[model samples]
Target: MKSAKSETLKGWALALPLLVVLLGFLLLPIVMITIVSFWQATEFSIIPAFSLENYEFLFGSSVTYKVFWATFRYALITWALTLLIGFTVAYYLAFHIRSSNVQTILFLVCTIPFLTSNIIRMISWIPFLGRNGIANQTLIGMGVINEPLEWLLYSDFSVILAFVHLYTLFMIVPIFNTMMRIDRSLIEAARDNGASGRQILTNVILPLSKPGIMIGTIFVLTLVMGDFITVRVMSGSQAANVGRLISNDISLLQYPSASATSVVLLVTVLLIIGTLMRFVNIRKEL
Candidate 1:
């Protein structure tokens, strides 16, 4: 009994720090948000009173639904593009490359974009994608079009383009890590059994890479869904999303409204992550 009690105490001691951090940071903030979400807010003052007005407003507004649809649309499109590009890159790195040194170097190359701040990298695209910018000038020089494409920047295309550029690394790294852990003998055996390259990839590699793909999907979806800056900057405020909605509410001194919107967004993101985790053993795969 004494030994077991001592071990239990030690375990608790180890876990205490994490428990403290989670309670102080994550749980406390959520509790505050939930509380504030029920409180009343005015233009000049936040009143300490309980009300469901914020939620009623949020749910009743057609604008809210449209913004959420835009959020989901961004998540889906970004997820698809990242998966396709990330999978291709990971496969080439894991299977095609013979030398581990070369693979490391190439992987490092992929991370070079990450060395700069995200804002700077995103802003850099403006010059490249703008009218009379590199892309437009190059296309014009090649006689692809007579005039500069206005939709190249400050549009949905730019938003998605920036998303793919920024988050592709997130998708690539996880998939590559998972792919690296796959057994070489399985691939060799599949080859020896007269399995085609596609057969080997589909049967052997893809099934094993699910954890990574799911993880990457989670990362990209969360980032894109919670992002207001990207949409605002890239779309020139023409596009609306849940994040921007919350931000607008906050800017207008509507604390209750922002909190309510934030709570809804939190629930939505949690549901998505929960659903994905239900099918995959992310901890085991990692």
Candidate 2:
């Protein structure tokens, strides 16, 4: 009984720092934002008046609806592309790369982009896609096109490509970790039992790796949904996303409306992640 009590105390002591941080940063900010969302802008200061007008405006506006749908559509596409590309890379690394040292080097290379500022990385694309860029010069030199393609620099395609480039590694890491845990003997046994590589992968490997795939998908979806920088930098004026819309509201000093929009976005993302978490052991991956 004494030992149990001591262990419980130790656990609580260890958790106290995390608990304090959560309350200070996340919980307090959320509480404040919730309160602020109810405030109304009077002649001078925002008055504390509880109303659903902000949300009503957000939902009622056709512009917000379009932006929300755009955000959702981008997230869906990003998640799909991340899964496909990440799975191939992770599968090859886990199964084909026999040398652990080489695998480690490859993984480090994959993470090098993350070491740099994300904004810098996004900006780098402009040089490659600009009017006097390599893409244009090469195209014109090779006679593929007589002129530079303006569409390449600022379009939905560029935005999606940037998203896939940035977040694919997030998906890859989780999938790779899961793939590495798969037993080598399982594959050998399947092979010895007259199963081909494709059959073994389809029947055995895929089912076992569902947790990783699910986790990667969720991560990509949530991150893409929340991302503003890539959309703004890559899409230019051709596209509008929810993050951009929220930024516009904040810039215009529509604090209550922005808060309401943020609250809705946070709730929607949480609900989606929560639903996915029910079917996955996300804790194990972490």
Candidate 3:
């Protein structure tokens, strides 16, 4: 009885710090945001009165629909690309690489992009795609193009490319961690039983990695949906996203509208993550 009490105390002590932080930072803010989403400010003040006008404006406006659709479209495309590339890279690292050292080296290389600031990485694309950029210079020098391409920057393509570069690592790490935990003998047994490489991957590997894939998808989709800076910097004023719309509203002291937009985004992301979680045991499956 004494030992059980001591262990319970120890567990409580360990969890206390996390519980405090979660309550103070995450839960508290979320609760406040929920309250504010149904509020309207008077005379441009910090204090807001409770109302449904914000939500009414959000759901009733066609502009909100357009912005949300744009955000969703880009986010989905980015998520799909990240899943494909990240899984392929992680799969190779886990199964094909025989040496632990090589695997470590490759993993480090995968993380190199994350070492640099996202802004710097996105800015780097500007020079590469500029009229005097290396790409244009080489193309012109080789007579591949008569003139520099205007479509290189300030376009949806540029926004998607920047998003993929920034978020692919999020997908890779989870998938790789999950893949590493998979029993190697299972793959060997499948092969021994006359399963081809494609058969093994499609049947054994993918099914087992569903949890990781779902998690990575959720992360990428949510992050991309909320991002505004990358789209602004890379695509200039040509591309508009939900994040940009929120930023614009906030800039004009439209807190009620901004909070309403945030609520919608939050609910949408949660819905997606929740729906995915239902299909797999994210923790144990991984």
On TM-score, the candidate that comes out on top is 1
lDDT accuracy of residue 199 in candidate 3: 100
Ranking, lDDT, top scorer first: 1, 3, 2
User: After aligning candidate 3 to the native by TM-score, how far in Å is the CA of 264 from where it should be?
Assistant: 1.0
- Residue 283, model 3: lDDT of 70
After superposition, which runs of candidate 1 have C-alpha atoms over 4 Å from their true positions? none
- Give the per-residue lDDT of model 1 (tens digit) for 81-168: 9999999999999999999999999999999999999999999999999998999999999999999999999999999999999999
- Residue 90 miss distance in model 2 (angstroms): 0.8
Clashes per prediction? Answer: 0, 0, 0
The digit string of per-residue lDDT tens for model 3 on 47-84 reads: 66778888888889898898889999999899989999
Ranking according to TM-score, highest score first: 1, 3, 2
* 2 or 3, greater by TM-score: 3
Q: Score every model by TM-score.
A: 0.97, 0.93, 0.94
lDDT of 3: 0.89
In model 1, residue pairs whose N, Cα or C atoms come closer than 3 Å (at least 3 residues apart or on different chains), thus clashing, are none
Q: Which numbered prediction scores highest in lDDT against the true structure?
A: 1
Q: Which has the better lDDT: candidate 1, or candidate 3?
A: 1
**What value of lDDT does candidate 2 attain over all alpha carbons?**
0.87
Write down the TM-score for model 1: 0.97
